[model samples]
Target: MLEPGLYEQTISRELKDELESEKDELVSELRKIDDAEAPKILAEYVAEVAESALARISESGKDSLENQIQLTNKMIGALDSPSDLVGDSHQLLYLVPKVMHQIRGKSERDTLRPETPMSQSSLFTGSRHEPSMGSELKKEIASADRIDMLVSFIKWPGLRIILPELREFSERGGKLRVITTSYIGATDVKAIDELSELPNAEVKVSYDTRGTRLHAKAYVFYRKTGFTTAYVGSSNLSNPAITSGLEWNVKVAQRELPDTMAKIRATFESYWESNDFEPYDKSQHDRFVEAVKRERGDKTPSDLVYFF
Candidate 1:
C-alpha cells in the first residue's frame, strides 16, 4: 500500500495508474481471503505487517509518521461537521482493526503498538545489570510497559521475587514473553510450567539446546518513559541470577544502541519463530522433568549435565 511508485506518480499527477497496480495485488489477496475468517486474518496480518514496517523505518521516518498522524488529529478537531471521534487521537490505528475484527465474528482488543526509535547510553559498569548491586533490574521490571525475557532456565524461587511485580504489570495490560530451555537437567520443567500460567504471559521452551547455539540471557523492557531497555549477559531466569547471583550482563539502551537493540530483537525473534522452541507443554514437561531428574541422578557432581 506504500509503494514508492505511488508517491512518484502522485508528483507527476499520474497517480491513478500506479495506485491501480498496487491495489491489484491487495485486491487479489482480499478476494482469496474472502472466508468466514477473513476479518480476523486481515486484522492479524495488518498488526504483524505494521509492526515490521514501522520498526524498519528510521528515526526520522517514525517522526514523520507520528507528526502526520498528530497533525491530522489537530485538523480533525476543527471540523465542526463531524466531531464524533471513534477512537482517541493516540489510538486511531485501532479503529480499522477493531472494525475488521468485528466483521470477522470476533473481538480483539489491544491495537498494534507503534514503537518510538530509542537510543541511550549503555547501562553497564564492568558487565553488570546495574552500576553496582542495586535493584536496577527490579526497578526496570516495575517500570516497564512490557517485558520480554529469554533465559536458559527459570527457577521458581528466584522468579518469586519478581513474580508479584510481574503479575501487577500483567494486570495493567503489560505483556510477558519468556523463552527458556528444557535441556537435560539444565532448566527445571516445573519452572517453565509455572511461568506459562501467569496472566498475559506466554512461555516457549527449547527442550534440548545442547548443540543448537542457545545459551544467551537477555531481558528487554519497553518502558513508558520513552526508552527501550535490554540486558544482555550471562544471567539465567533463576532466583540467584535475578536477585544476588554474580552474573555479567550488559544493559543496552535503544536510543544509544539502536543497532544493538535491533539485532538483539531480531535474534530473539529468529529463535522464537524457529523449531528450536515451542509452546510449553504440560505432559511433555512432566516427562522431560522426569528425564532431567534421572539424568542428574546418574551424573557425577563434576560432570556437566547441560552446556551451551
Candidate 2:
C-alpha cells in the first residue's frame, strides 16, 4: 500500500482540483458581466480564490491526496497569469513543477488508492521548497512595499544583503529610520555612513551596558494600502549561522500596517532610551568593553560571557 503520508497527498490533490474548477467557473461568470463592474468582480474572485486555495493547501498539507493534485494544478495555472494578478504567485509557480517531477510516470491509483498507490516506488519524488515555515513568511515579506529592519547584533551576512538595500533607499531619499545597538561592526558603520550621504536619512545607534537582550528580529514594511511584518526565530543574519551552521527565521505580514508599525516603533524606542547614543566612533570599542566589565563587576564570568 502507499505510505500513509503519500496517501494523504493523493486525497489533497483531488480536493484542490475541485476548488480550482469552482474558481474557474467564478472567473468565467465575472467576464460576462457589465464591463464597469469587471474590476470589482475580478478583485473579489481573485481574493476568494487565493483565500480558498491557501486554506485548502494548509489544511491538507499533511492529510489528503486530491488536495495535493489541486494545489499543484493551481500553482501551475497561476504561472499562466500576470504576476500581480495572483497573490504570492512566486512560491506557487515554483512548487507546481517541482512537485510534479516527484510523481511523474507514477500511477495515481497505484500510489494513492486504498491499495494500489502504495505498492509502487519507481517514480520520482521530492519537495520543491525547503521544509519550513520560511516559505510562508517569505511570501508575506515580498508582498510589502516598505520595511523597517531592527538590528542589534551586526550579523555580517545579513547586513551584507540588507544593508545595501537600506543604503540605496536612503540615497534615493526614501524615508527610513535605523535604530541599531552598540555592538556593531566597522564595516556596518561604514555602510551606514554611505547611506547617510543621502538627504533626510536618519540613523541612530545606542551603546547600552544596562539593557537586557533586545533579542528580537523582525521587519515591518509599509505601503499606501497595507503593511507586512515578520519576526524570525533564528540567527539568519550572521555568516556562520546562515551559511555554515543551522539557522531559522520567520516573516509575518498583514494588511494592517499602522498597528505593526506602532509596535515596532515602540520596541525600538525602548532600546534607544535604555542605551546611550554617541556619534559614530571607531575608538569606542574599548569604552564599550569597559562599560560591560563594570556591569559585570569584573571580567564577566564565563557562563555570562557565553551570552554576551
Candidate 3:
C-alpha cells in the first residue's frame, strides 16, 4: 500500500543502521583483545572486506574475486612475514639474472660461427685488427682454473710480459704446468727459475735436445665454467711471437670441438707423465745450464755463461 519510493528509502536506512551496529560491535571486540592480538583480528576483517568487495565487482564482470582474494592474501602474508618475503625476493633477484645469462649464453653458443674475429675458433694472425696472443693469453689466464703451456723454448722477455698475470693466477690457487726444452738454447734459465718459484707452478724440461725434438707450441686454458680453449699453431711463448711477430695460431674451443680438446688433454697428460720431460729441480740448475750451453755449442765456462 505504501509508495514505492518511500519503501525503498526505509529499507535503505535500516540496512545502513545495521551496518553501523556491526561496525561498533567489531570495534568493541577489538578493544577487548590484547594490543598484539588486535592487529591480527583487524587484518582478518580487512581481508574479508576486500574479498567481499571483489566478489561484488566480479558479479559485474570486472575481475575474478577468487584471484583478487588470493592476491590480497599473498600481499598480506608478505607483510606478516617480512623477513621471509625479503629472503624470497633476494633469491629471485639472484636466480632470475643467472637464468637469463645462462639462456643468453646457450643461444650465443648455438648460433656461433667459426673463423670470425669474435668467434672462439677464429684464426689469430696477429694482425692489427685481431687480438694479440699476449693479450688473449692474459685474458685466459685470468679466468682459468688450470693452465698448460707447451713450447719448444720460453724466452725471458715473453715470460716477463705475462709474469704478472701468471703470478696473480697462481696466487688464486690456479695450477700451472709448463713443458719446454733446451732444444735450441733459446729457453732462458732465469725464466724457468722464475716459473718454478711460482706458488703453484710446475715446469718440465727435456734436456735431450736432439732426441726429444719437442717442437710443439700450444697453450691450453682449462676453465671450470666449461669454456676451455687451446691455441695451437706456430706461436711460441716468445715476446715477438706473442706480441709483434707474424704468428699464426688457431684457437680451438672445447665446446665447438670436444674430440680435439680431448686429444689435446690426453696428449698433454701423456707427455706430463713421460720420462723424457723431467720436473725442473732448483738444485740441478747447474746441470740445466750445462745442457743449454752444450746445445748452443758454446765452450764458455759455466760461471761465465750469461742467460739472455
Candidate 4:
C-alpha cells in the first residue's frame, strides 16, 4: 500500500502508443489544412491533450500542473514551427515525435511521485542530510550565494580558515550578514572587525554582557539555483565549531525541510533590528577589544574559553 498522501501510477505502454498514433493523425490533419493558423491550432491541441491527461494533477500551487502543461506546449510549438510552418511537410512531420515525447515526459513528471522516493526519515536520531557537521557545513557554505549567520560568539582564527573562499565569495557579490554577541569574552574583536571590512557584508553584535541568553547558533546559506540550506545546532562561529568538535548541528534544505530556512531568516532579521544589537563598526570594535583586553588582564574565566 502507498504511504499517506503519496501515490504513484505508471502510464501503460499501450496508452503511450495510442497517444503517439493520435499525435501522428493530428500532424496529418495540420498538413491537410494548409492554413497559416494550423500551427496555433496544434499548440491548442497539445495543451488540450495535456490538460485532459493530467486533469487531476497539482503541484506547488493550485494551477502549477496546468501552468507547466501550457508552458511545455507553447515551448514545443515555438521550437517546432517558428515561422510559416503550414504546408511544410518536413516541419509538420518533425513535430510528431517531439510532441509525443514531450507530452509523455510531462505526464510522467507531473505525477508528483518520486523517481526513487523516500517516504520518511529516521525521526528518533540523526538528520535530513547524512554524515556529520564540519564537512556538510563547508559544502553548503561553498554552494550558497548569501550567508546569514547567528551565533553568540565569533573568533577571527575560525573565520581565517575560510577567509580565502569567503573573499572569493565577496568578490563575486555574495552577501554576508552576521549577528553575534559580546556577552562572554568568547567573541573576538578581530573577527568582527575583519568581517565588517568585507564587501557586501554587515556584522552586528549584542553588548548584553551579563546573562545575554542569546545562544542560538545557525548558518543559513541561500543558493542561486536550488533550495536554501541552514545548519542549526550547538556549533558556534569558532575554530572547533566549524572544523572539529562534538557539535550537534544538522543540515536542512528549504523545500524538504519544515520552514527552517524561513524561520532562520526571520529570526536573524528580528535580532538584526532589535536595540540590543549594534552594527559592528570601528568604535564598537575598539570598545569590544579594550573590554576583552581588561577581561583577559585579571584572569580568563573558563566560560570565556571556547566550549562545545
Candidate 5:
C-alpha cells in the first residue's frame, strides 16, 4: 500500500541519521584530546585510514595495473619522510577539504581565493612577481562597498593616479572615509580638497602637528560579499609608495584571517571615533594650509610684520 520509492526514502533518512550520530560521536572523542597530543593522534588516524583504503583498493581488483602501480609509487613517495608524511596527511585530511568547500562555488572561489597561488596572505614589495600596489588599490576600490584609508599623509601624485577609480566608486554610491595627519607637512592640501569634494567621501585631519604622532598607514576595502581586504604597512598615499617604491605592505583577507581583520576594523573605528583627528571642513581650508606651512617651517605673509 506504501507509495513507490517511499521505502527507499525511509532507508535513506535512517542511514543519514545514523551517519550523523557517528560523526557527532567522533567529534566528541576528538574534543577530549589535549592540544599537544591532537596532531600526533590525528596523523596516526589518517595513516590508518589511508592504509585501510589502500588495502581495499588492492583487494578490489577493479583498477588497472598501471593505475595501481602509479598510486602505490605516489604512496611510497609520500611515506619517504615520516615527519613530512604527518604534515602532508594533516593538510590532505583537514586543510584540503576545508579549502575545497570554501572554493566550491564559482563566485565564492573568486571572492575567497587569494589572487596569488603562493598563499592566502600576500606581501607587496613592489617586486616583478607581485602585483603593483596602485593597481591592487584601484581594484579594491572598484569592487568595494566602502573604503577606509588611514595614512600619515597624502601626496597629489599618488592620489591623482587613483582619483578616477575613487570618483567612479563614489558615483556608484560607495562610501569613502580618510584619516590623515599634518605631522610633517607631507600631505598636500590639494589632495585633501579633492578627496573632500568627492560625492561620498569624508576626510579627517589631525592638526595637532606637534603632539599627534599618528603614523600608521592602512587601506581597508569592505565588501558586502563578506570577502573584505585590508592593506597595512609602510606605504603612504604617495606615487612611489604605491607604484615603484620598495614599500612593504601585508594584504590580509577577512576570509583567511578573520581575527586579524576584526582587530583592524576595531582599531580603525576607535581612531575614527577619537577626537584627535578633526573632521575636515572647506571653511577651515586656510587653517589647514597654515598648519601645514607651520609644520614645514614655511613663513606665511601673516608671519611677516611691516615696521613703521
Candidate 6:
C-alpha cells in the first residue's frame, strides 16, 4: 500500500479517512467478488466509476474538485500494491479510467475555454501530431552516428550518381533496404538497378505492365537516437519533376519509426508475394478499388482507373 507520503497533505488526510470508513464495506464487497463467477463485471464497475469520476474532474477542475485527482491517483497507487485485482487487465480497468479523468480535468482547468484566447499551452496540446521540418533536423542528421533509409523513390537526378554513396555504405559496412514502384520505367528504373547491384543492399521493384498507376511516395531515415520520415504528395524521383515543379512533403520525426517500418515491410512483402500472379488476381486491392468506384462517383481516383 502507498504511504501517506505518496500524497499531498490535504489529499492524504482525506483519502486515509475515506479508506478507514469504507474498510468494512470494501471487505464485504471483495468477499462477494470472490464468490462471483463474473469477476470481469466487478472490474468493469470499478473502471466505470473511475471513468465517471475522471470525466467529472475533467469537466470541472482540480481546484473545483478540491484536488480529487491527487487523491484518486494515491488511492489507485495504494490499490495497486496488494489487491485481488493486481493483474494488469483488472488493475488497468480500475485505475486507467480515473487517471484519464484526472488528466482531462487538469487539462480543462489549466487550459483556456473555447471562449478564451488561445496561447502557448493551447497550441502545444491542440494537435496530437504535427510536421517537424527545418534546419534543426538537417543539423541533427549531419552529426548523427548512423543513417538507414527505405524509400519508394528518390527525387535526385541521376540516382545512379548516388550509387557511390550506396557503395560507400557497403564499403564501410552498413545496412539499407529500399523498394520502389512507379507508373513508368524512367522514374525508378535507374535507382532500383543501382541499389540492387550494391554488395549488401536489398531492393525490390514493381512494374504495372497493364498501365496500372503507382502513386504513393514515402521515405524513412534513421540516425542515432532520432530519425525522420517523409510522406509526400508528389513522386519526384526524376530530375525533371523536382527541378521543374512545386512538390510538397510532410516530414515527421522518426521516434515512431519502428511501427512505421513494420507497416512498410509488410506492404512490400505483400506486393512481392502477389507480383508473380496475373494482375487480375481479384485480391483485396481489387475489391477496394471496385468498392471505391461504386460508392464514390466517377470523379474518385479509383473510378478513373481500370484494373481488370
Give the top-scoring candidate (TM-score): 5
Alpha-carbon local distance difference test for all models: 0.63, 0.44, 0.75, 0.63, 0.76, 0.42
Using alpha carbons, what is the TM-score of model 4? 0.55
Query: Candidate 1's error at 140, in angstroms?
Result: 1.3
Better of 4 and 6 by TM-score: 4
lDDT of 4 by residue, 236-297 (tens): 77776666555676556665544556777887888889888888877776778766665456
Model 4 residue pairs with clashes: none
Candidate 1 colliding pairs: 118-254, 118-255, 119-254, 119-255, 119-256, 120-255, 120-256, 158-239
Give the winner by lDDT: 4 or 5: 5
lDDT ranking of the models: 5, 3, 4, 1, 2, 6
Q: What tens-digit string does per-residue lDDT give for candidate 1 at 1-308?
A: 44432211111234445556677464422134558866666655555554565555434564766654554455446555345532443532323456566765332233122121235444333334334312455656655788888887566666776677677778878898888765546666666776777778888876554655467788898865557888888767665565556666677887666668889889888988988887875656776677567646766534742332
lDDT of 3 by residue, 1-308 (tens): 12223221212355556646666344321124568766755655666666677677577665564555556557758678644432221211112357656766754433222223222476888898977888888777766789999998788889998899899999989999999998767788998999999999999999987679998999998877677889999877778888988888989988767779999999999999999999996986898898888887754435322321
Candidate 5 per-residue lDDT, tens place, 178-287, comes to: 99988767888999999999998999999996688888999998987677889999888988888988888999888777779999999989989999989996877998
What is the TM-score of candidate 2? 0.42
Best by lDDT: 5
Between candidates 2 and 6, the one scoring higher on TM-score is 2
Off by over 4 Å in 1: 1-119, 123-134, 281-283, 294-297, 300-308
Stretches of candidate 5 exceeding 4 Å from the true structure = 1-119, 298-308
Error of 1 at 221 (Å): 0.6
Instruction: Report the lDDT of model 6 for residue 140.
Output: 26
**1 versus 4: better lDDT goes to:** 4
Which candidate model has the greater TM-score, 1 or 6? 1
Better candidate by lDDT, 1 or 2: 1
- The predicted structure with the larger lDDT, 2 or 5, is 5
